[model samples]
Target chain A: MTRILADRAARLLDFLWSGWAGLAALALLFACWQAGHETWGDFILPDPLATLGATWSLAISSESRGLLLLTAQRALAGFTLAAFSGAVIGIIAGYAPAVMRLARPLLTVVLGVPPIAWIVLTMMWFGTSGATVAATILISATPVVFVAAAEGIASRDRGLGTMAEVFRYGALGRFWFIDLRQAAAPLFPALALALGTSFKVAVMAEMLANAGGVGGALARARAMLDVPQALAWVVLAVIALVVVEYGLIRPMQAEIEGWRRAAQPWGVKK
Target chain B: MSAALELHRIGHAYFGQSVLNSIDLQIAPGEVVALVGPSGSGKSTLAHIAAGLVEPREGRVTPGYARHAMIFQEPRLLPWATAAQNIGFALRRAKLPRRLRPARVAEAARLAELEPQDLAKYPVELSGGMRQRVAIARALAVRPDFIFFDEPFTALDVALKRRMQDLVIAAAEEAQFAALFITHDLVEALRIAHRIAVLDLRGRGIAGLRILPGDPGARDEATTFALRQRFLTEDPLFRHIHDVDERRRP
Candidate 1:
């Protein structure tokens, strides 16, 4: 019971600190915006306050909310598909040197081809539907996850293998409990990168394919010379990225990797 | 019963470098035998061979006992796991009832003199001595008939090393687990071992053996001092150890 309370208190403290960090980040962003505004004027880079106002307007519009939801679902679906497949395949490849060697060239090829190039092929296959956007997101994001997971698995401590043998952990028990725990921290940067990639690719795919979402709205804003609205949609997409990456992934990370916190010193060393 | 662990004519080499050659040894149940030698005498290789971690290139390693555990040079704890969880990890193969694991883990911690509060903390949170204690507890928790120590106390400070030596002697007394303790430190071998086997640095194997005078755990300071004096003055291996050091001078 006390442990439970301590956990909650730690989480609550993390959230509070994160909240403060977000505000500090926003303050820095505003300074950059102010500088950019002075050089380029409102035509190229609209006032930061104006972009916020435009974002507020989008938040209030029911149509915009639906578009937001659609884009978010596509990005999330792609990220989920990529994260699972990448982690599974990467782990399998990690164990089998032959598989890893074969997959290396394929991974490079897949990652090397730009997402923009894939959008045209996806459009031809999926006919500008949500499928096109999802496919684009997948092609663009999967290699990042795959590469990260493979490295994580490769870098795991071999000493633990002897420990596992001595302790009598079965193959499955070692994989699930020990091997996966060892891989957790290394997988984090990959998962985060894949997430950010999904959002960017989804938006790009939506713009090119003309699927209904904030991306379509962004396309219309671009056509009509509504710079603030275009910037507003970009802000909304970044907000969505932040929401999924932090609100969801980060909390799970805290739970899984909190032991690392104990290693950190609270004060400077003498 | 026969010896808990016996190695007959064990020989091994890496790429023909010949790390160990024609070694034979045995440990009876509840016996503490220390294998001591200079830096490159294959003490760890011998320990590993006895524990079945390494297959001897020649001869046989026979384990008469049902179970065995090892204390490595490093604590080798799972960094992500708490001390209790690390202990529990070792118990996974022991086939204990799921409901009873925590109690067993707690019992192991008590045996190792680990503080209950520290049990919940991860390896990174613990000091070196505490981590080593956790490793000791992990080895003891299995209640093995045989335990192999591969110079596990070398990293510890002098005081902590004595405490760990006492812990080993006490565990051997209470648990009756035969141990093949490996180290290069003559003083440490004398402190904890009933019998000390000296390994030949020149590949002759099993150079000599010495039986200390009294119970290892109960020996007085005077006895230890006298034993050291006798080793330095009379033991040919000890004389060679000193001579080897003298030979390295410019």
Candidate 2:
């Protein structure tokens, strides 16, 4: 038990140390943003500091904070729906080739249709509500997770399956312990991609449907030509994405992928 | 006396191509029987059939043992799990109480000669030999009366292979488990198996069986080498053991 705790503590420290690289990358991005602001002046692109000030003011106000919460809820709800259903269907399709064959064309059709079209359609179907935003996000994100999970299951090592069979693992037991565990390698990356898509589509649907969220706030800023406010809302949306990805997705990924880290020898760990 | 495992007219085919046909074999309790064959002789297929990993196209597998485990050609350890966890994986199937598992896992690890610190490491973090040790530990953890080894040490270097064979000999002797050890190497078969069964080139049947002079693990290296040389050079049953017919491999 002490060894496990110590290992977790070491991993936590390693995670914190890795944040320096992330900060360095963020600084580089900010430098490029500053360059663009200087090139275009205040009319086209606002300076990063001004945008930060606007973001801080917006974040401090109760009204804008509520809007942010609404958007986060919509994104999370839609993401949950997509993750669950897509993973189930994908896993089923993965095990059954006929179902996979059927799902392929359907996935192609769903992916081929643009997210803007879905947003427009969902707006008509669900009106200017959270449902519209959520439906749009689901339509846009489900296929990514579906494809990922399906491929993950399809490519699993059959040797492991045989090994499980030798141990007398039943169908459900093998699926739970071996197949699903193997599928997680590809599934996690797909989930991360799907999550990003969810948030993006959520905000886009909200803007188009006039739902009261950060996207609606951005639309208002656009109407008034408040570039700094618009940039602030964009920044807020990005911060929310980073928070969800790093806060939820990355920690879970780290826990599952520790073996991958162990594969790397000492003095070469990143 | 009842045999530990009995294969009566066991036959199997893949995609209508018969790979194993009308093979009959039996292992007494606490005996290590080595099954040696050419590359395409369906040795692994027969082992898989005996272990119940594959359904035979015909015939029955009557397993008289309480439980059985297998160690495959590759380590086949779950890469995501620690070495200890890999051993515990089999223990989970054994249905031992959850709290008692750690001790069982540690005991099996010790039997496999793995270091205490190595238990926490993943398969990829360990050396190739260590990875195979984890596989052996996994098989041993189940505490079965019967075990199947499908060329478990075929991938190891010469020295490592000998060590693993010795480990298996020690494990089987200590546990008194009946084993069907499949190998292409005659020396390996001689060193580890009490009796050697030569499989036919076309999987027609068990070609022949030879009982070695002394018990397994008691035979010296010089005797094993001499027996191996005699089998390869003089024994007609082993004439096709070293042959590689890729076209006929199932």
Candidate No. with top TM-score: 2
**lDDT per residue, candidate 2, A29-121, as tens digits?**
989999999999998999999999999999899999899989999999999999998999999999999999999999999999999999999
Task: Tell me the tens digit of each residue's lDDT in model 1 across B143-248.
Answer: 8888889999999999999899889988888888888999878888888888999888754578888888777888877888889889989767777653344243
lDDT of each: 0.85, 0.90
CAPRI band of model 2?
medium
Docking class of 1: acceptable
Per-candidate iRMSD: 4.2, 2.9
Q: What TM-score does prediction 1 earn? A: 0.90
Q: What ranges in model 1 sit over 4 Å off?
A: A34-42, A96-109, A267-270, B202-205, B237-250
lDDT over C-alpha atoms for residue A207 of model 2: 89
RMSD of 2: 1.7
DockQ of 2: 0.65
lDDT, candidate 1, residue B64?
Answer: 82
True contacts kept of 2: 0.82
lDDT score for residue A23 of model 2: 95
lDDT of 1 by residue, A1-270 (tens): 896787769767776876888799989999999899989999999989999999999999999989999999999998998899888888888777888899999988897888999999999999989899888888787777777777777887867877677676667877887778777887887899889989888988899899979789899999999999999999999999999998888878877887777787851111
